[model samples]
Target: MQLTAIGINHDTAPVALRERVAFQFEQIKPALALFKEAWSGKRSLSAPEAAILSTCNRTELYCATEAQSSREQAVSWLSQYHGIRTEELAPHVYALPQSEAVRHAFRVASGLDSMVLGETQIVGQMKDAVRTASEAGALGTYLNQLFQRTFAVAKEVRSTTEIGAQSVSMAAAAVRLAQRIFDKIANQRVLFIGAGEMIELCATHFAAQHPRELVVANRTAERGMRLAERFNGRAIPLSELPSRMHEFDIIVSCTASTLPIIGLGAVERAVKARRHRPIFMVDLAVPRDIEPEAGQLEDVFLYTVDDLGAIVREGNASRQAAVAQAEAIIETRVQNFMQWLDARSIVPVIRHMHTQADMLRRAEVERAQKMLARGDDPAAVLEALSQSLTNKLIHPPTYALTSAPANERYLLKEIVGRWYSPR
Candidate 1:
C-alpha cells in the first residue's frame, strides 16, 4: 500500500473552483464513507484508509491504499462526488504520493501552507477532519499515524520556529480591509454571520477596535448568543439579517452553508435603507455567504477569501526567515515519516518469513517426537531434527542460489549474503 494526498487548494485553483470541491463540515463524515466505498470498488481491494481536510482554502483527501489504486482513481472519485468532470478537475488537482503527501500534511498543519502564512487555525481544522474520519471508521493504521505525526510536527514547528510570529491571520486581514473602507472601525456597526470559529476569530479582532455595535447572526440563536457574549456583543437570529442588514456598516461572514446566504436583492434593499451609505462585506465562506453580484453595487465593498490574497502575501516578505526555519523543520519530520513508512512496507514480508520459519520448526519437532516415541535414539532424533530444520529454513534461498541462471548468480549471491549476514 502507498500513502497519497490528492486535491485542489487555493494555490492550484481559483476560489470558484475551490468552492465547487469544498466539502461542508457536516458533509465530511459521509463523504469519507463514500470515498472509501468507491475506492474499494474501483481498486477491487478492501476499503482504504482515508481522511479529508476541507477548509476555505482547500479540500484534500489523504489516503493509504494498495498500488492497484492509481492517483487518477482518487481524482475520479472526488470529481464524481462533487459532480464535476475529471478533465475539469485534472488541471487544478495536485496528487502527491508517499513522502510528498507526508510533507504536505506537515506543511499544512504547521501553517506553512495557509493563505495567511503560519496561521494556526489549520491545525485545529485538520484535527477536526481526522476526528470526523475516525468517527466514520474511515481511518486505519496509516492515516491515524499520519495525522498523529502531523500534529506532532506542527507542534514542534510552532515551538522551534518563529513561523507564527507577527503573522497576519485571515481574521486580521479582513479587519485590515475593513479599515481601508471605513477610516475608523470604532464608529461602524459590525455584523458577523455564523458563530463558528471564523466568526469567533473575526469578532475578537473587530471587538478590539470597539465597533459601535457588534452583532452575531446564526442559524441557532443559542450558539450565536454564546459567541456574541464573549465580546460583549448581541446576537440575532439569521432570519433577522435581511431586515437588519442596513444597520451594520461592516459585515464579515463565514458559514458552512452550501449556498450563498446574502443575495444581491437583499443587499440592494439594505443599501437603500442605509441611504446608499457604503457597507464593507467580507465573505470568508467557501461557497461564499454573499452573492458575487452583490459586489457590483455602488455602495457595497465586497471581498471574498480570494480578494485578501495580496494583503496576506504582504506578511510573507517579513516571514521569510521563519518560513525557511519551518521548512527545515518540516523537511526533517518528512524524512522521519518516510523512514517509518519504509519500515511499514517490509512488515508483511518479515511476517511471512517468520511464519515460514515457524512452520518448518513445527514440522521438524513433530518428526523428532515421533522418532523418539518409536524407540529411536534421542541424540539421533535431535540431530535429525536440527538437520531438517536448518535445511528447510534455507531451502528457498539455497535452491535459488544453485539453480539461478548464470546471468542472475551475482544478484543471487548478494541476496544470500544479505540474508545470512550478521547484524
Candidate 2:
C-alpha cells in the first residue's frame, strides 16, 4: 500500500494553471484507464489505483503504487496527458507519500484544505470522483480503504468541530461582491447562466433580496424554467443571452462549457447599451464562462473563483479555534490510518508464519495416526504428538536466538515473547 497524492490545488497553483490541469467530468473515467494503461506492466511501474478530485478550487489525483520512483513517473504521465511541460507543472505540484498522503487526504475531505475553509461541497465532489473511479475499475483495495476512511473522517470533523461556523460560502461572497457595486440588490437585474448546483446556490442567496428581475439562461429550457419558477423568476434560452446581455446589471455564470460563453464582444455591446453602468460578473466555471479579457471593461467587475478566495478569507480569525480542533482530530485519525497501512505491509510475513505452523501440525498429526493404526498406546502417541508440535514451533526461534550475536539477543528475545505470547 504505497499511497501518494499528486497534483495541484488553490494553495499551489493559480486558477489559470489549475484549469489546464483539471479533468472534466466526462473525461475522468477514460483518462484514468489510460493513466493505468500507460504504465501497465512497464519495468519500473505497476498498475496503479487512482481517483481524481477536480473542482473549481482544486484538482488532485490520489494513487497507490509499488515503486518509489514510479511516483515521479505518475507525475510525468499527468503532465503529458494535459499537454503541460514537466518544468511548467513541476513547481506547483505536490507529491505526498504514505503517511503524508493519508494526512493530506483526511485534511482535504474534512474541508480543512478548501479555499473557502470548511466548505461542504467538496465532500460531494470527492464522492462523485471516487464513484467514477470505481465504475472505471481504477479503485482497488488500498484506494478503497483510503476513501472510506476519508469519508468517515470528514463526517466526524463536520459533526464534532465548529469548523464550518461563520463560514463565508461562495454564494454569500458573490452577493457580498454584488453589494459592493450596487447599493441595493433588490434594485438590480440579475441573470444566472447555467442551472447547475452552483447556480442554484447563488440564485437562492440572491433571491433573499427580492431582486427587481431574475432570469436563468440555460441550454435546457425546461430545467431552467423549473429552477426559475422556484424563485418566482423566468427562464430564457441560452442563445438569447447575446441579444439580451445588456438587460442585466449583474451576471453570474457557471456551466460545463469548454469555452467562454460570455465573450468580450457580447459584454462590450452590453456595456455600450448600459452607457457604462457598472455590471458585476462572476465566472465560476473552470474553463471560465466569461472571457478573461472582459474584466478589462470599465463597467465590468469580473471576479473569477480565485477572486472570491480573498473575499471568503476576510473573517478567518474567528475560525482559528475550530480549525485547531479539526486539525487535532485529523492528526489522530491520520496516525490510525497509517497504522492500518503499516499492518497491511507485513501481511505476507504473517501468512508465511501461519503456513509453516500448519505444515508442522499436519506432519505431527500424520505421525500420531500411523502410531495408532499400528496398535501403539493411544495416550502415549497423543502425548508424543503434543510434545513434538510444541518443539517444532519453538525450534526455529530457539536456533536463531542461539546463533544470534550477543548484541542482537535482546531484540530476538523480545520478538520471541511477542510471537509466543497470548493475544
Which candidate leads in TM-score? 1
Cα lDDT tens digits, model 1, 1-423, are 789898899899999899999988788888888888887876678989999998999999999997644778888888888899999998999989888899999999999888889898999999999999999999999989999999999999999888999988888899999999889999999999999888898999999999999999999999999999999999999999889999999999998899999999999999999999999999999987789999999989999888998799898888899889889988998999889988998999999999989888888888898999999999999898998788787888889889999999999999889888999
List the candidate 2 regions with Cα displacement exceeding 4 Å. Answer: 44-46, 367-380, 418-423
Off by over 4 Å in 1: 404-423
CA RMSD, predictions in order: 1.8, 2.1
lDDT per residue (tens digit) for residues 208-243 in model 2: 999999999999999999999999999999999999
Instruction: Please report the candidate that would top lDDT against the real structure.
Output: 2
Give me the overall lDDT of model 1.
0.90
Kindly state the number of residue pairs that clash in model 2.
Answer: 0
Lowest summed lDDT over 10 consecutive residues: which window, candidate 2? 66-75
